[model samples]
Target chain A: MAILITPETKIIVQGITGDFGGRHAKLSLDYGTQVVAGVTPGKGGQFFEYGAHKVPIYNSVADAAKATGATVSVIFVPPPFAADAILECVDAGLDLAVAITEGIPIKDMIRVKRAMTGAKTRLVGPNCPGIVTPGTGKDSFGGCRIGIAPGYIHKKGHVGVVSRSGTLTYEAVFQLTSKNIGQTTCVGIGGDPVNGTNHLDVIKLFNADPETHGIILIGEIGGNAEVEAARWIKANCKKPVAGFIAGATAPAGRRMGHAGAIVGGAEDTAAAKIAVFKECGIEVAATPSDMADALLRAAKAKGVTLT
Target chain B: MNIHEYQAKALFEKFGVAVPKGTTATNPEAFVTALAALPEGPTMVKSQIHAGGRGKGTFTNGFKGGVKFCKTKADALAMAGNMLGQTLVTAQTGPVGRKVQTIYFTVASDIKKEYYLAILLDRATSRPVIVASTEGGMDIETVAHDTPEKLFKVLIDPAYGIADFQIRDLITKLGLAGAEAKNAAKLIRNLYTMFWETDAAMVEVNPLITTPTGEVLALDAKVSFDSNALYRHPEIVALRDLNEEDPKEIEASKYSLSYIALDGNIACLVNGAGLAMSTMDIIQHFGGTPANFLDVGGGASKDQVIAAFKIILGDPNVKGILVNIFGGIMDCNVIATGIVEAVKEVGLKLPLVVRLEGNNVVAGKATLAASGLALVAGDTMADAAQKIVKLVA
Candidate 1:
């Protein structure tokens, strides 16, 4: 009942020949994901060899998808080519494309996003830690581990975690795992101002998933995405949700690492987002360390068992 | 990256977007020559800095304004002299202010009316939007708050570009007519071209003026390009003024580290941007102020750790350091070893708290224990932030 992917989801890795792509592709394989094929444009007919897993490589996404029957792709292409890689996934009609690459130009992403309108391929991130639907195996091994997120911290269960920050997502997941709480899925929509997915998009998916009993929504300063998501959750989502927004102490106009993490105006500040979350009946995590406990409180108030 | 007003004006001209003819001088001696490039009539003397609210800014030397209107070239030159080297404190620029290293002189246009125009991505629609208003030459935020109806927006479909109907709607909203309307339409088209071609994050013309002669001009230009797209725009990169940035931040960029200097005293070095920001928040939560936000990125090397330490230590306000790492793809042991080496190399006296989690954390903790450095260890981010705050307290 994971939202986007599962242990049985067949996946392809774009930019599989590069150092970063190859390394993560191997890690994804080690996590027991069904890494069916690889796409490197010019590296066709080759195979990425890691331990016993030898994933075949094709020159194009279409070729890879056609031969291997892979439905999803995780892109690790460099920024300059990342946009084209995303478009190729749309062209090949992949169910989803998880872009792990960062630093893609905003213009490129704006075009990529525009082109993806009404398309079948749902793009995840251009500057994000990807998605994970935790496996039932030990340490959440054998799950659909897509991007650069560490595969070991996850546990298979009902709580859905969605965030824009990589380590913050891990922080929440780790907190949940430590308390013996498992998650149905975890999605990082990314920190880029022009990303494929937003907080609202992932929240809707989580709310729709019957298996996801509770949700953790992590956001930061900048953009009205978090506010939009919070308002939506209040009106429609009946599931328990905990929220955490970073950059509370951040100064105005200073970009805090993430391209989209800057405080643009009064509406998008951490304070404003936190207020909206609280107003929406969300149990707000006072600190990053309290994310798991906050969710527990929300679940208890709703009389739902997350574990 | 934000370019100076003069640079933005030059870029505007390149894209067929009209602006007041301007010249810049870095020294007072060249102010006269720079002023000569403009007409004999009224001129605008502006301090070239990255921040806004320059028109109302006061200089440290007791000079009245960063921007001034003068009737003669000699008067413009005098105003330029007052601004060229003095620090101008504005609402946007913190109390410390920024040194005015360059002076911009432009021929003042006789405004028939002032309008506001900007091209930026609309996050809601995921498209380029033109925010236009009849109210201009003032804080747009204020206008948005007080007179919301005066402001209008036209979302440009990336697929079809700006439509003629949208332009007409915008022109009507702005109360433009005849040649002014035609000129404004052209300017909007050209501005969109520049925004798309240059990969600009935002193109803001605070007062898009229609002169008495019916010529539409961008009276003030504030353009920022996407740093991610800077590789394709070497021309824009060349316009980068290093003087406007913190030296420590510039140094951090050289090592691919993301660092921003803050006003607090507790310096934080962490892995991942989100975690780094959270570390700062956690520090603040514990009643300790964070001096800086430094993300060493994933897979930080030994050299990067040393560089980060140097940058954090360079800030005189820093009383203690907190190193938080949640190694995902990153190996915790590698980071721990790097931290140990960084401390040994930098010769730290400030109290330091290190928290390592995730991959190879056991080995990482063991490495730190064996190093025997005078560093406190925390089991989690909360523990680490509290430890640093308490130690510094």
Candidate 2:
């Protein structure tokens, strides 16, 4: 019932010859993800085994797509080449592209975004931990463990978890898991300024998922992304949602964590985002623990019973 | 990752963005030599420190006061010598900080037209946004705050490049006419190219000035390079000013950890800065103290984790250690390995409390099972903070 990725989705690994790429590809295969092919220029005709299933490798994304019909492309190219890698995937007509590479130059992403306008292909991240659909066994990137639902602290209910910080997504999930609650899906939208997909984009997907009852959003200080997402959640999302904005106490004009997490001007701050979320009638978590509690109360108020 | 103005201007020049002729002077003698190299008469002297507010600094202000038009090379040398190595306490760096390392000597231009221009990655839109304002030379923070409407911000289309229409609109907003407008538009396009080529995190030209002779030149420049993208930009990597950075932060970067010094009493060792700062805030709220802010970063190894612990413990103000780790790509077991080993090596008598979560939590817990070290493990941040506060109190 999760959006974007599923067990049935065929995956292609771009830059699979690289160290990080090869490692993630092996792990993804180990996790039972249907990794169909690998793409690395000058390394075509190679093969990597995922159990009994032999995975073929191609030189470019276009060749890999033609050979294996891989719908989803997970890019592990270096920062400098990440933009070109994503562009290659888009050209190959991938249904979704998940970029694991961090620190991509903003201008390169700007060019990538320009090329993606009105295109059918959807990009997930240029600096993200990628997406994971728990229990049903689906993950875009390698690190997320299968069947290990950190969001299981919140009892099996309809709450969808969305976050910009990759680690914080796991934090929210861990909190929910501790409470014995499970999420329909947890998304790590990424904190890069020029990341693929966003909080609002994921909210739309979650809103349409019948299995998803409510939502929990974890955001950091920086940008108006949270504000934009809160507006969308208020207008469109019907389910109850809880929000937690990190970096509320961060010093003004300091980049606390992510490059994008800096307090830019007035509009980009945790306090401001929390205010917007509160004004929209969405319950706001004062801290990480508080966020998990808020989600619990939201589900309880909606008459959802714990298992 | 921030380059000096002279270096940034060189990058701007390469991309065909007009820039005033300037050179960096390391010493007072070099300052005089740089001033001699530039075309004579009333050149502006600016102290080059990473921290802003040099114009209002005591040393700079004192040097400027001593100068009566600096009509000769001797006068310039005397002024430069007096200013060099002197501490400049300003509004930016509160009393007694940041010595003037270098001074920038430049040919002053009669600014016929002033426009503010900056290229930054817009996190919300996930694109590079070129922010321009006709109201230039003032602080951008003030402009963004008071009169945001006066600014003309456009998301640069990476594919087609900065569109002709958008550039024209920006020029019009800048109140340029005819040839000046066309030239300004071209400058904007070139600046975009420079911004891309340099892998700049932020490229700002405060007072993108049009000289009296109908030439637009970047009067002041500030460029911050993407530290992560430094792998590809070898030239930028070489330009890193080690003196301008905190030694601890520099040392931590070698191990791929991000650490920032803060004025607090309780030194924190956390996995993420968001969590670290939050931990500090929680400690403060609970009437405990936080001395420094340290984020060991993701995927920390045993040695790096040990190094982080040692670095935090090294701080004199640190009475106790609060290790808050919400492991993800990093395994809790690995962190436990580091913590146990570091505690043995450092042999601290200070109270310690650990809050660990995520991958291999059970394994990590198992490793810490019989370690009789004054260590307490909590499942949550609240519990960990409360426990640490109790121990310290």
Q: What docking class should model 1 receive?
A: medium
Candidate 1, residues B1-393: lDDT per residue as tens digits? 989999998989998999988999998788878877787989999999999889899999888889999998888877787888899999988999999999999998898888888888777777888888898887777777788788888888888888989989899889999999899989999999998899888888989999988999999998888899999999999999999998999999999999999999999999988888889999999999999999998868988988999999999999999999998878999888988898998889999999988989999999999998999998888899999999999
What stretches of model 1 exceed 4 Å from their correct place?
Answer: A256-266
Assess the local accuracy of residue A32 in candidate 2 as a C-alpha lDDT between 0 and 100: 60
Reference contacts recovered by each candidate, as fractions?
0.60, 0.41
Q: Write the per-residue lDDT of candidate 2 for residues B1-393, one digit (tens) a residue.
A: 787777788788888988877666887557756877878666666667665556655753454321123555455556667666877766656564667788776666677878888887776555777888877888776776688788778876555667889888878877888778777888899988877777788888887988777888898788887676778778888888888777778888788777776666566788765576677767776778777677787668899988887777766777777888887667889998889999999887888888888767888988877676768887788888878887878
Write candidate 2's Cα lDDT for A1-307 as tens digits: 7678766678898877777777767666666667888888898998876568688889999999988787888888888888999989889998999887777876677778878988889998767767666553222232222211232222333558888766667777777666666666677777677777888898889889988877888888777878888888778776778898877556655562222332244657777888999887678886776777887676677675432
Candidate 1: global Cα-lDDT? 0.90
In terms of TM-score, which candidate is strongest?
Answer: 1
